[model samples]
Target: MLDNKLTYVVGANIKDEKLRDYLKYTENLSGRFIKSSGLTGKIRVNNNVAKLNHRISSDDVIDIDMKTDEHQNIEPEKMEIDVAYEDIDLIIINKRPGIVVHPTHGYPSGTLANGVLYYFKEKNEKCIVRLVSRLDMDTSGLIIIAKNQYSHMALARDMQSKDVSSKESNDKDLNNKIFEKSYIAVAHGNMENKSGTIDLPIGNPNQDSARREVCDEGQRSITHYEVIKSFKNADLLKVTLETGRTHQIRVHLSHIGHPLYGDSLYGTVESEYIDRQALHAYKLIIPHPRTGEQLTVESNLPEDINNLISKLKSEA
Candidate 1:
């Protein structure tokens, strides 16, 4: 229903630590970005693109691509979603472990989208799959749901360009677009520093590889980390991404001599939770696609992780 372009630099950050708060609290605001950038476009974020409550930072440029288009009806799904928060414009859900964000293989059904579709189907809300962000199949945390297509494009644009990016590849090598993303993880050993950054290039090793290798020819990747807690034999840390590559967190941690506990792909199988890696997405920040507002979401540790931490601390 909004139909005006608005833009600004955030003068103050409300108590709402997440940008979605602003989207929900402000009446005139239409869109925002959690991790915004320098760019311009005509994208009106709707309820479907991103939530309004996400955190927006001060001195950050914002633009609102207010909707001038006809309305489309979307229904809501009553499917059990651990909704961190919700509004007409966006939905933030805590994704369960072991569920892929999108469909593939024999997982066309029983996915998060499947539950979402069924929930919306029951509510008669005109809903569609316009996810603003993606989480790994086993990663559990806040998953952002953009309600519409315009906001999807706007948000997607900013996420795709947060890091050093390029679009040039030789005919012999037509695969090169680099971006950075941060993460939080529990490492198996004691690191010497309070914080550090890891730079590595991740790339394909063979045709259609599910695994990535550490190579100089690979794309550029960076991961920054700070120890949050130290356990008897393990440590908890918050990782900030500087690039977005498949398994970037896992790979970076492994490369930096602190592989994630139980990480079968990279680390030794000497941890308590052998089936799961000790990594959880604790926070996500971005700018709203439609309104250019800043947004952020934080999640508490999953029960499995908390239990492990507790047990580790008890031993200490």
Candidate 2:
């Protein structure tokens, strides 16, 4: 079970409301979380054990446990994982390309989540592993794993605050942003300028649709890129995403005539420098969930990308 607890103050408008109604409507608690806490007898009202149907007053204090009930079927597997940082609240790991983050179709084992689960089990920690951000299977880089619900909610809210496409809240409150993620990539052609921003819109299509596209009806997507090193045939770039959308970097780069090297899904021609896409999430900056201090985590380029860079430099 996680150490973090969900607490809320009952408002006057929700006076005399049932405990379940207060949790569901007033505090916006998840049904799954409530159910799990109910089974474990962790739900409380005014520091007294209360049932879901208990009536709460206007000034009542509700405290709910944040433990999660997940991965009922998935078992932990011990695999080598590159840990970048670890604390009581969260962990940052360098994920390799070609391996999915979590268990998905055709890959139920050997995933990063499975490895993390084993790590937690070895440490004798009883908490659910929560991924704050996701990277594509072919995209390698630093990723965050929250140890509790509070940290997960903080990091997830930070990501959503930076997202210009989120209609849930106003984007003017930039001070609330607590995380910054950057990437390093090798694209097909030499960039036109040293740095520029791509402010396009991304559209999510139906489930049967193959891919997202730049369209008028799409949400606002922004990506800023700077040419780091120019090679004979390719350019190494440092890309900072102002808004995270699915395939934003790849799509924006491809739209500007510089598809990522070895990106078969979005590139015009095949690449010999690398087999998988040359995109790496090199840097991740986030505030500590408990302390509110800035934490910067980074990872070096993998062997294949490093060797490709060396080959390009030698040729240059």
Candidate 3:
């Protein structure tokens, strides 16, 4: 069952702090959320309804019912969804390629968000759909959806706090990060190096243009890639991002002279094995928003990318 309440036992570290301040800092709750919860009388101290200014002491029990009457603007539609993992705080969906993540200008309905809302409604959950991470319409992989305002706020803050300038890309460094996203792709050339880092700034040249390129005056973007296998004409590479920029992996791989196979927007090569970009978001490691425990979720490569890999191997 989904628990919509948060219970915190005051410790020495937070003793004597104001409830509002404790909620904002220690619990990572947004001011708006705190105000709303307070207005709705959802916060209690020691089983009694408490005000925001209530003084907290060690061993005091804090209970917060996080349920809200918030409603989504998008209409829920029944559709098949691949749920990779689900808990009280978050849902990790293994998104297939060629599906929009949410409703946008061009896509008004029939999105993953619509399906998720239907799923939630069927399960009698009355929370807003909050996307912690996003993927392009054609990029298949895992995407995160926060189940409540508190989880959404916490996860969003963690994503923003990521340090993209760090030079380390090893497993230890990745584990230390609040969130780690990994991808697998087939690039159009035999990589000269087995492993390398692409430290480049990315920005769109024109405000209206959707394409992004490396520029001196752009946001700092970093991508770390390791060639997993070499093929006659292409290479299978595992990629990890230090920064999440629009089209980061595509732009980085193309900039390094190894564009992904079948990438129409960024690649110069035409592929017969696949009709879309041979890229997949395969893994994610995140800290649970409420519990602070590490969670690792992964999705297997979709069939198109796998078929592309097999074709490359046969050509070798």
* Predicted structure 1: lDDT: 0.63
Tell me which of candidates 1 and 2 scores higher on TM-score.
Answer: 2
Model 3 clashing residue pairs (backbone): none
| Residue lDDT tens for model 2, 1-316 | 3346767778777667788877765554456656767777888988988888899888898887765554535578888889999877899989999888889888888888888999888987776669998898889999999987667766776677677766523644434646788999999879879899999998866556746777888888999999999998799999999888888899889888999988987887676778888999999988776556789999999998998899889998
Model 1 ranges off by over 4 Å:
1-79, 166-182
lDDT of each: 0.63, 0.82, 0.87
Q: Kindly indicate the candidate among 1 and 3 with the higher TM-score.
A: 3
Judging by lDDT, tell me the better candidate of 1 and 2: 2
Residue 196's lDDT within candidate 1 is: 82
- Specify the poorest-scoring 10-residue window by lDDT in model 1: 168-177
What TM-score number comes out for model 3?
Answer: 0.92
Q: Per-residue lDDT of 264-286 in model 1, one digit per residue for the tens?
A: 77786855653578788777766
Model 3 collision count: 0
Q: Which is better, 2 or 3, measured by lDDT? A: 3
